[model samples]
Target: MSGENETVTYRVEDHVAVITLNRPEQRNALNFDAYDRLERAFRQAVRDPDARCVIVTGADPAFCSGDDVREIMAGPKPAIPPPPTVRHAPTPAAMAALECDKPVIAAVNGAAVGWGMELALYADIRIASEKAKFAELFIKRGLTCDVGGFYRLPAIVGPAKAAELLFTGDVIDADEALRIGLVREVAPHAELMDRARALAARIACNPPLALRYMKEGLRRAAYGDPRELGGWAIETIRTLMKTEDHREGVASFLEKRAPVFTGR
Candidate 1:
């Protein structure tokens, strides 16, 4: 079904809920509003009994370029308040994809950077287009990995490889991602979605209840308590938000120039 907001759209076909990130003009870069809508879409897929599998992909030319840096920088800042005794809870949006027990696939047709990369990681399987690229770009933004990247990336790509990508914030082509096990398969750009749907259909043919239980078992085996890691990531990002490096990162990004970091 088409979403109320155009930033994200959802539809079900042959037992697969196909969710598309729709902001191609900005390379599907998300702001807070888009993120909220995406979370809702994921939740809807989970609740739909007929959706045995879910496929997430973006509009042509980009999957998602992470958060909209311009929007983040230009948005009004909230007033600082005293810290509460309890730690801040993670946002539901961050965990929405993972909360689904049914199989989920990422049809990475183009650039998937930062949060986009994390979103793809949340999927049980990833099918990439030859034109696709992947990156963990939070370091360049002077931010820690968010949206479960720290918990998921190492599990998918191994700890050492994950560190290199996370530290350098380097972009890798689809072939590189495939070689490193970040994606299960890569197809030509024109045929990426068809490949993803075929895979989703194959999985959907299995007993749905058994598939759900198997998915939960696999997840439990693969991930630790995400709550602790997610909490730490959030707090680290909060601290980074106040840093001079982060401010410079945003300013340099907006100005289209190299950022001069002082290690502040």
Candidate 2:
């Protein structure tokens, strides 16, 4: 079965559901609409009883370049109402991926930076293409990442390396990511999906119930409660968004210049 919308696509084959972020022209950079579609795609995967595993990949040339900075971050600030009293609501897309019962793999085909890297971290495992690159780019934008960075990155790549990536916003090539244990394997760019699907097929051959429980067990044993971390991340990002540094960061990126940060 296969289906597609403007920004996301879903297909199921051999008990594996594949979700593609579908904006190659834009390097799969997400807007609000893409985020909603991504959430829905993961939910659909979870609801499909035949789907024992899931693979998320982006179109050619990029995995996901992060948010569409032009659309999401370039505009003048709008006045907003206060958030509701609910203190621990994760973003819909992140929550959906995190809560998915099926084993999830990120097939990182190319650039996976900023929230793109966070998306990869949300997966149970990541398989990268030789062309893939990863980064925690939020600091360069004077923002913090969603919960995936804080909750999963440290566990995957060690606290010190995670701190360096998060603090410097430096990009890492696929081999570097592999060396740091950020990806399980790196395939030739042409074979990326084939490699991911082969791995997913092996995983899907397991008993569904066992796989689900095993995934959940690992998450519970290895990580802190994401809800609490998510709440804190959201609040910190909101505060940072209002700062002069954030504004300058956005402006400089749009202008293709170096960002001048002021500790305002």
Clashes of each: 2, 0
In candidate 1, what are the lDDT values of residues 1-264, reduced to their tens digit?
Answer: 495458999899789999899999999998776887898999999899889999999998899888888776445742112235435534456668878888999999999998899899889999999999999998997888874578889888899999999999999999999999999998999999989999999999999999999999999998855766766777788788888998888889988999999999
Candidate 2 lDDT, tens digit per residue, 7-66? Answer: 999888999999999999999998877887999999999899989999999988999999
Give me the candidate number with maximum TM-score: 2
Off by over 4 Å in 1: 1-5, 77-89
Candidate 2, pairs of clashing residues:
none
Local distance difference test, candidate 2: 0.89
Off by over 4 Å in 2: 1-5, 76-86
In candidate 1, what residue range of length 10 has the lowest lDDT sum? 77-86
> Which RMSD values do the candidates have, in order?
2.6, 2.0
